[model samples]
Target: MSERIKKELALYKLREIEIDDMKLKVEELKIGEQLGAMNYEEKVQSSMNCKNNDYVMNEIETLEKRIRFNEIANKRIDNALKRLDIDEAEIVRRVFIEKKSITLTAQELFKSRKSIKKSIDRAFEKLKLA
Candidate 1:
């Protein structure tokens, strides 16, 4: 595979991880918001709740930015895949987009490991040119 395609695949994988992390953060923030609301009765002594809410809000904003970035990256990947041949696109989708292991993808596609690898390499080459 060409270095450019490798870099793009690596970036797509990293963005997938980032998206998952951002989703988790968003969920945590939502839970925190719920908890903070529940503690509204205790607003007398622990003014710390207000501070915590501010922190949670800041985290939510950061998470939103990450989600938007991930969305854009996903669209780019989709466009790239669309430009590829069907078989090449399937290989790329299985390996990168679906996050499948090579062996697993091979099994699922009823292809030999070597064949799957070759397809992946060809996909990368196509993506590099694209």
Candidate 2:
């Protein structure tokens, strides 16, 4: 179960990158459209631009679908965390969601490293049962 949670966290991070890339592509397409409008051969260039815009629009739609799926997956993770006790949930959130190291989490939470590790281990045990 802990492994599954880790995998899901990794997937969530990858999806975030994918979504950012998609947004960048959309911006690039907009720039391309502006350049196409400035072309001296207006008729031919405009026709090509229209086709390109249609393709870009379709790609954006597909990207949006993937982003929505990822968002749903993240929401499910949040809901699962809610099932854990507050301290356990905080440990899980710091280590997994915030992507912090055990030492960093302990420092941030003002707890000893051993205590943090114990909380994390207990959190995983509860998450497994959950």
Among the numbered candidates, top lDDT falls to 1
Query: Per-residue lDDT for 1-130 in model 1, tens only?
Result: 4766656665787787889888998998898688658454664445787677777888899889979988797788889888888977888787876678999998988999999899888877777787
- CA lDDT of 82 in candidate 1? 89
Residues 43-73 of candidate 2: C-alpha lDDT, one tens digit per residue: 3465765577668668767777876887788
Q: Write down the lDDT that model 1 would get.
A: 0.80
- Itemize residue pairs with steric clashes in candidate 2: none
- TM-score of every model? 0.65, 0.71
* Candidate 2 runs further than 4 Å off: 27-50
lDDT of each: 0.80, 0.77
Question: Which residue segments of model 1 deviate by more than 4 Å?
Answer: 11-14, 38-47, 95-122
